[model samples]
Target chain A: MTRSLTTVESRLRKQKPDSGQIPFGRTFTDHMFVMDYEESKGWHEPRIVPYEPLTLDPAAMIFHYGQTVFEGLKAYRTDDGRVLLFRPEKNFERLNLSSERLSIPPIDEEEVMDYLKKLIDLERDWVPEFEGTSLYIRPFIIATEPSLAVAPSKMYKFMIILSPVGPYFSGGIRPVTINVEEEFTRAVKGGTGMAKTAGNYSSGYQAQEKASKEGNADVLWLDGVEKRYIEEVGSMNIFFKIDGEIVTPALSGSILRGITRTSILELLKEWGWTVNERRISIEELYQYYEEGKLEEAFGAGTAAVISPVGEFNWLGKKMVVNNHEIGPVAQKLYDTVTGIQRGRKEDDYGWTVEI
Target chain B: MTRSLTTVESRLRKQKPDSGQIPFGRTFTDHMFVMDYEESKGWHEPRIVPYEPLTLDPAAMIFHYGQTVFEGLKAYRTDDGRVLLFRPEKNFERLNLSSERLSIPPIDEEEVMDYLKKLIDLERDWVPEFEGTSLYIRPFIIATEPSLAVAPSKMYKFMIILSPVGPYFSGGIRPVTINVEEEFTRAVKGGTGMAKTAGNYSSGYQAQEKASKEGNADVLWLDGVEKRYIEEVGSMNIFFKIDGEIVTPALSGSILRGITRTSILELLKEWGWTVNERRISIEELYQYYEEGKLEEAFGAGTAAVISPVGEFNWLGKKMVVNNHEIGPVAQKLYDTVTGIQRGRKEDDYGWTVEI
Candidate 1:
C-alpha cells in the first residue's frame, strides 16, 4: 500500500523562515504530501511538493458545507537526532473511520504512513530540538468538488501539513476550571459526536466563549437528551477518578473516539488500575465529590495530553477537586504516558514509530 | 449599522468560456469582501479586494482544527429586471448565531447586508436571467490565527463570495426516496446540531452515501438516543402531513434552526393549515401511514424550498406517502414559497429583501 512520492524542487526552493522565532504554529516546513481522490480514480498522484495555498473554488463543498475530516499527531526529535512518530497508524485508522462517517473516501493506512515518512524526510530540519516542542503533522481530507447539492463531494483532497509548535500549556500544568454548559451540547447519540470532524468544534465555540467569559477554562457539555450525563470537555475526553478507580464516559454514540483516551485506558489496565468506561452522570460526580470520594478529574487528548481539572462549576455552583491540586493518579498517568512519548523510558507497548 | 461600499477587483482573469454550460459552485465573481477581527481592534480593515489566494499559514485553525462557520442564500433576478433576496436579514441573524457558537466575532447584520448589497451591485451582470437561476451568495467566517493551542482562534476572517447557480433539483422537482439512518446520527440533543457549521454536515456524509448507494435519494436522521424520532432529512428540514395537519420535529435543541423551515411554518399557518411543531416520532408516522392517514412528507430548505418525499424505508419497512406523486399540500407550499421568492407573487410576510 506504499505510495511512490514525486519530488518538486521548485516548491522546495520557496522556503522562507519566520525569523526562526519558534512560535506555536507560525512557521511551516517547505514540503507537504498530497493525494487526490475521485469516483473514477481511487487515490492517485501522491506527491511531495512545496507547501502552498490550495486553489479551491469559493463554492467548494469544504468551505460552505464543511465536508472535511482531520487527524493530529506529532513528529518528534529524539536525543539521538532521529525523527519519530507516536502511533501514527492509529491516527490513520481513526482518520479513515472519521472519513467513513463524513462520507469521504478512506485511504490505505500503510500508504498514508509511508507518505508521512516521506514528508518527514523532506522536512526533517523543521523538527524542533526543544524539550517540549515538536513538528506537528496534520493529515486532513477536504471535499474539493464545486457543487452545492450537499449530499457528498465526489472529489476530495488529502493533504499532510507540518508545523513546529510549542507545548500547549504555556505555564506549569495547573488545574483548570470548567463550566458545565446547559444551553449547548457538542454531540449527541446518532450524531457526529464520535467523529473528528470540524463542525463539532465550531458549534462549541459560543459555549466556550461563555465559559471563558464566566472565568472558566473550558465548557463541559451534558448529554443533549436529559442534559444530565457528563459527556466531554471542550476538545478532550474526560475521566473522573472515583473510589480508587478511573471512570470515563463510555464510547456512547455521542463522544469522539479519542486515540489518547484509548491509550490511557490500555496503559492504566497494564499498570493494574481499574478502568470503567460507562455513563458517568454529572449528578453522580457532584455527589461523589461532596462525599470526598472523587479523587481526581482530568481530560485526555493529543494537544493537552492530560489536563487536570482543579475546579468545576455546575449550574452556578463550583466545586474544587482533591484540594485544588493535581491528584496522585493523574500525575502518575501523565508521567508514565509522557515518559514513553518522549522516549525517556522503555517502549513496552511498542507505541512509538521510529524514523 | 450599514457600512459603505469598499470595492476591489478580480486579480485572476476569466479562463475562456468552454461552452454554453453552467455548473454548481465552479465559477466565482471577481471581487471578494473581507474583514478581520482582533480583540484590541474589534473588527476592522473592511476591504473589497481582488479575489486572490489567501496567504494563510499552513497551521491556520480552520485547516487543522476546523474552527469555521458559514451561511448560504441567493440574489435572485426577477423578470422585471430587479434583484431581490428572500430574507437576507434572517440569514444574517443565523450567521451571527453560528459565529457566537463557533466563538468567532459576530458582525452587525445590517452592515453585512449592506456589504452583500454592494457586492451584488458590483457583480450585477453575473446574475443570470435563466428562469429559476440566481447568483448564490456564501458568507463564511474562519479562524485564521496560526496556533495549535486547540482553543478558539484570536483572529478571524469574515468574507463573502458569489457564484451563479441553477435549480437545485436540476429538472422539475421529482419526489425522492429517503432511507432512514439507524446507525449514524446527524445531530444529537445539546450538540451543535442547531448551528450551521461544517462538522455537522461532514459527519452525515457516510449516512448520505449509504442511502444513495442503497437506491435512496436522501438519508433521514432520527433522534440520537432512541433512533425513532425524526430530526431532519439530509440537508433539509422535513414536514409530515397527517389527517389534514402538518407535523414537524420541534426545536428539540438538536434540530437545526433552519430559516426555510420557519418560513414554511409561517406560510402554512397563514394559509389556514394546521402546523404542529412537536415531537413526531417515526413510529407514530408509520402507524398513520399504515392507516392511510399520512397525506404527504417533504423536506424544506432554501435550495429546493420544498421537495416531496415519495417513499421512505423505515426499520426494514417501506411506506409510500402519495404513490410517488407530489402531494397536494406539498405542491401548494412549494408554489407559494417559490412564487414569493422569485417575485412572482405578493410579499405579505415581508420575507423578500430587494437588492
Candidate 2:
C-alpha cells in the first residue's frame, strides 16, 4: 500500500465518441490503472499506463482455470460540471469478497480504491457529460501464472479500465417480459453464485438466448435446488410488489448481493414502506396474481437500476402484471437511484463521492 | 476441413527438459498450433508457430465473462521411438461438447485433430522417453473479442500447447485419502459441470484446499441440489467397487464425461465385470462401508491414470478401503491402460494413433 504510484500518459489520445452515440463497453479511455501481485512481493508497483492490450502466456492459469474476479461501477458527470463516483468503495470490497470465493489471494481494498480514484482523476475528461451518459469502470484481476495447473495461481494482475457508456435504455424506459427459467441453473449453494467472478456471467447466456428467441426480453432464473423459488433475473436482483408490500429475495448464498439492490432497500426503508425479504416461490407469485394481489415486479442491478417486468412465463402459463406498463414504484426507484448517481438529487448518505 | 496446415519453425530452439525431472504442465515445447475464429471468415488461418505469450486486448471477453473451453490429452513415446496418441480424437470431440455449453462457436473437430497431429509430430523431440513420462497436450479456446458485452464472443482463438509431464506418481503408485465435501458444491444438474470449461475448475479450489488442510488429498463433491449424491472428486471422475461390482455416478447432466471413465467402462465391459453407472448417494456408500461391502475406490482422469482411494472421510467418519493400499481392480486397470498407451499391451480397440 505504501508503494509510490507511477503514471505514463498516452502520446496519442482517441477521439471521444459523439454525445448520443456512445456505446456500452465498446470504447475505452486513454489510460488504465494496473498492479501486479507476486507471492513474495505481494501487490506492488501500482501504475497508471496508456490503455493497451495485455500480453500473457498461452498457458496462463486464467486461460485454463478461470481464477479471476471483476467489479463494475460507474462514474457520473453531473450537470454542475463535476465528476462523481457512486459507491466505488463498495465495488472494491465486493471484488475482494469475490476473490476469496475463487481462492484468489486477498488484496488491500483501500489501496485499490485510492489507486482507482487517481486513475479516474487523470482521465476526468473521459467522463461523458451528456444526459444518462457516464464512464463505466471495470476492475478485474486475472491469474498471470504461466502454468496449466488446476490449482490457484501464484501470480496475478489487477487492472482498472474505463469505458464511456451511453444509457442502458436509449429510449424511454419500458417494461419487459421475462420467462421463468426452469431448465438452466445459474448458481447453487456453496458455488461462485454470489461472487462477481467471470464464469457466472457467461453461463447464463444460453438461457438468455432461449428467452430472447421465445420473444421474452430476459430469463427470470429460479432457485437451483427445486427450481420453484425465485432467485434473480438476467444479471440483476429481482423484487416484486404484492398487496402494497415490497418484497425481494433474501441474500441466499446462491444470489448475488447487488449494490443497487442494497441502495433500493435503504431508500425503501427510509420511505417507511412495507418491505419483506424472504423466499418467494413462483407458485405463490402466480397464486397472488390470480387473487388480484400481485402489483409489480422489477429487477435491480448496476446495469439497469430498475428493469420492470411486464409478464412472467412459467411453463406455458402467461401472467401479466401492471397491464404491461411500468409501475409507479419501479419508476420512482429508477428516478431516485439515477438522480442520486448523477448528483441531481440530495446526497443524504455518503453514496456519491466527487473527484 | 480441407484447408492445408501451415507451419513456422522456431529459429531459437530451446533445450528440452532433463528426463525424470520434468514437472507437470510446465516446460513447453518449441512450437504450438494456433487458429483464429471470426464471424465473417469462420475459423481460419490454422498455423503452427513458436510457443509464446498471447497478446489480447484488455477488454477481451474471456477476462470479463469466462467464455472458454479446453481439453487435456497425452502423447506417449513408445519404446521403439514412435510417438503415439491415445484417443486424441475423443479429446477434440469433448472440446466441441464443452464449447457448445459455453456458447462458443464450435470448431471442426476433425480439422483440429489433424492440426494437433502435425504440431505433435513437429515437437516429437520434446516428448520425454523416461519411464512413466509422456507429452501432455492442452487444446484451449478463448473468447478473444475486445468488448465487455455479456454475450457469446464473436472472435475467438484456439491454440494447442504441449508440455513434458513427469510420472504422476514419480515415487510409486500410492493410495490417496479423499474427503466427502459437504459444504461446497462442484456442479449442479443445470450448470457447466458437464462441460470442461474454465470456471468449473477454479471454483472447486476452495474445497480442495479445505480437504488438503484436513490431511486429505482431494475433495469428493456431491450433487448441488441435495448435497447427497456423489458427483466428482477434485477434477477426476470417481468409481467405487462394492459387493464384487464396480459403480460410478451416472452422467446425470452435472457429472463430466471423462475420457478415462469412458475407456474404463469399455474395458470392464470387455472383461465381463459387473459395472453399474447410476446415481450413488453418500449415505449408501457409507452404509456399504459399514456392512463391509465396500471393496475398492479410485479416481479416473488424464493426469493420474488410476488414483486409488485408500481412505474416505465423510462428515468425520473415516472409512478405510482395501486396507490402505491399491486394490487389485485399480492396479489391473492402471497397468492395462498404461500398457496399451506405452505400446506394451495389445490394444484391441482403435484407441491410439501413431505418428
Cα lDDT tens digits for candidate 2, A199-246: 998899899899989999889988888998899998789999999999
lDDT of 2 at A314: 90
Cα lDDT tens digits for candidate 1, B1-355:
6545557677576552233246666677777788888888877778788765566655667766677778888888788988888989999899888777677778988887888888888788777777667788888888878765667888988888877777777766879999988988777765667778777776777787778888998888898767889999887999999999999999876788888899989888888988899988888889999899998999998777899999999878999989999998888888888888889999898988887
DockQ, all models: 0.52, 0.89
Scored against the true structure, residue B67 in model 2 reaches a CA lDDT of 96
Clashes of each: 9, 0
Instruction: State candidate 2's TM-score.
Output: 0.99
Please give the CA lDDT of all the candidate structures: 0.81, 0.91
Highest-scoring model, lDDT: 2
Show pairs that collide, candidate 2: none
- lDDT (Cα, 0-100) at A212 in candidate 2: 89
Runs of candidate 2 exceeding 4 Å displacement: none
Shift in Å, residue A239, candidate 1: 3.4
